[model samples]
Target: MSTDPTRETPHDLEAVDRDDAYAQLVARYSAPERVAVALDKVKAEARRRAKARQLVTRARGGLLHNHTVREIARYFRKAERGRVDLLQVSEGTGIPLTDSRQVLREFVDAGLLYEYAEPVGKEVRRSYALAEGGKGGITEVFIETEAASRLEEQENRARGTLGWGEA
Candidate 1:
């Protein structure tokens, strides 16, 4: 035999073919149920997180609305003896007159604000002020309490969903 090693080898090609076949067989028989279950769990967790975020946003909105209403009521209670019109309240609170009117209307409906209507064409303008019970009005307390309750409920739900205390 000639002493030469620069020749094509059949065993090298056969080994590569065997490796490919083994990989294909492993892929074809793999079980995917575990991956599917994990994916489902991830999706469910995402949905729960989204709902918790929505609750937080709603709670914050209620808190802000209650705080603003309280501020407006406090402003009126501290004003001079004379009545303050909606425009004056709006100017003092740095809120638009239209928004102030809306808040006034809500407070009036809720019995937290009292409205005084002057005679038509009278030089004196109509005005609004805190109701008879002043800052301790039932409506004001109700709004504040409701906001607080909602915030607490949201926090509890978030904590429970995130498994904060669960073993």
Candidate 2:
């Protein structure tokens, strides 16, 4: 109980960092099982943060994320007409024209949208319509977090195939 202002006694509250205090308390008093559970919680939080960061990185790299795809679907569902063109989608969704076109083409390639050239007077206009249960298809669409390591992986090639029903 010495009253030295500049001295950091062992009992002083500010002498040790918060993390060191927690470590010392847990090590000395916590049971083994409780310590293991605490560690597991810490690891799960780290993984969750890492995954969120990875998703942000992927979106920044020009890859559309799950929420963006859902937003496009919502626009199509709420639009006056089922059939639309790239420009219409860009304006309706408020996404850039280039990004809208790219995402639509990706869906077309994935068989979610039916694309055709419509004759608008003398000039042809490209149009797209949602396939059967296109909203359902959009819901099923998943963004790849990582690229497949092997070129010969058939699963990677079959991107949007329907899930195999349970045996």
Runs in model 2 with CA error above 4 Å?
1-62, 65-68, 78-80, 119-123, 142-167
Residue-by-residue lDDT tens digits, candidate 2, 119-158: 9999878888876545444433332322211222356457
Q: Which candidate number maximizes TM-score?
A: 2
For all predictions, the C-alpha RMSD in Å is 22.6, 17.1
Residue 13 in candidate 1, Cα distance off native in Å: 99
Q: Per model, how many backbone clashes are there?
A: 0, 0
- Reference-based lDDT, each prediction: 0.58, 0.59
Q: What's the CA error at residue 51 for candidate 1, in Å?
A: 28
Question: After superposing candidate 1, which stretches have Cα over 4 Å from the reference?
Answer: 1-67, 79-82, 119-125, 138-167
Expressed as tens digits, the lDDT of each residue in 11-68 for candidate 1 is 5665557678998877776646667787886665455444333333433576335444
TM-score of candidate 2 versus the correct structure, residues matched by position: 0.41
Instruction: For candidate 1, report its TM-score.
Output: 0.40
Which model scores highest in lDDT? Answer: 2
Candidate 2 lDDT: 0.59
